[model samples]
Target: MTSYPMHTVDTAPAEARTPLTVLRETFGFVPGAAAVMANSPVLLNTFFSAFGHFRGGTFTPAERQVLLLSNAVANASEWAVAFHTLEALADGVAPEVVDAVRRGARPGDPRMAALSGLTVAFIEKRGHLGEADVKAFTAAGFGEGQLFEVVAGVAISAMANYTANVAGPPLEPAVEPHAWTAGTGAGA
Candidate 1:
């Protein structure tokens, strides 16, 4: 397998430096996946742009975490799974809900379940959702617009997840405790 550098702000390419710096300042450190993504300024910036839009979208922090975690599990990205696991817990998603998402099972909370279900379906089906998929998401109180927002979340996660899969960055310390193995999850 090919290896990629885990770049720091000082070591990243010129265009990637600014975003790495901002990420470091915001998170107190650059995440492992982002570090690897710094290999390409375009990839890093694109991920950051989509991430910014997703954060500004309609989902609550917990709901966003649910969708992100679902995407991670569905993509079978170990680094993403661990990162999203910690973020999900920190964002106040219930432990059981996080676990359920990690296991690729429906979450216990109605709203989270709906979010996770649609997100997993979105990924597993490659955006070719059935009518019931759309209805289930709407019935959970999410609007059609929010369904599109989930698309944004899935897209954002896809970039990160695919990056991690390809680069195989080491897990950051903060997320290490929540580390995952690809086939360990029930979904695998």
Candidate 2:
């Protein structure tokens, strides 16, 4: 198996150092996956850029977690699943809702179900959303603009998810309790 270094802010490449430091300060610690991704300045920067845009998008924090967790599960990315599970819970998404998404099922909450359903379809269908998909999303009270926001969330999650799958970073202790295994979840 390939191994990757977990870089610290000071240890990261010059171009990656600032972002690493910022992430550390923002989250109170750098996520393990991001630490590994710091090996490639371009990859780390791209993640940061896309992530920044997604955070600034229209979704509330809980809604964003729903989309991101669904993306992680659809991509079968264990690390991202765990990380986003923690974030989802911290962001006040219902525990049942988080559990449902972690299990690759729709949430009991209608709005969350819509977000998860659309995000999974976005990844699973590779952006070829059918008319029914758009209709379901909009019918759930999401606007057409938020459909595009889901695209942004998916893009950000893909960067993190794909990196974690390839690099296999160790899970941070805070997220370890939520550790996931691909195929353990229904459609994961």
Error of 1 at 47 (Å): 0.8
lDDT of each candidate versus the true structure: 0.89, 0.90
**Clashing residue pairs found in predicted model 1:** none
- What's model 2's overall lDDT? 0.90
**Pairs that collide, model 2:** none
lDDT of 2 by residue, 65-128 (tens): 9999999999989888999998998999999999999998899999999989999998889999
Over 21-107, each residue of candidate 1 has an lDDT whose tens digit, in order, gives 999997788988899999999999999988998899889999999999999999999989999898988899999998888987898
Q: What TM-score does candidate 1 get on C-alpha atoms?
A: 0.96
Q: Against the true structure, candidate 1 has what lDDT? A: 0.89
lDDT of 1 at 27: 74
Instruction: Give the RMSD in angstroms, all C-alphas superposed, for model 2.
Output: 2.0
RMSD of each: 2.0, 2.0
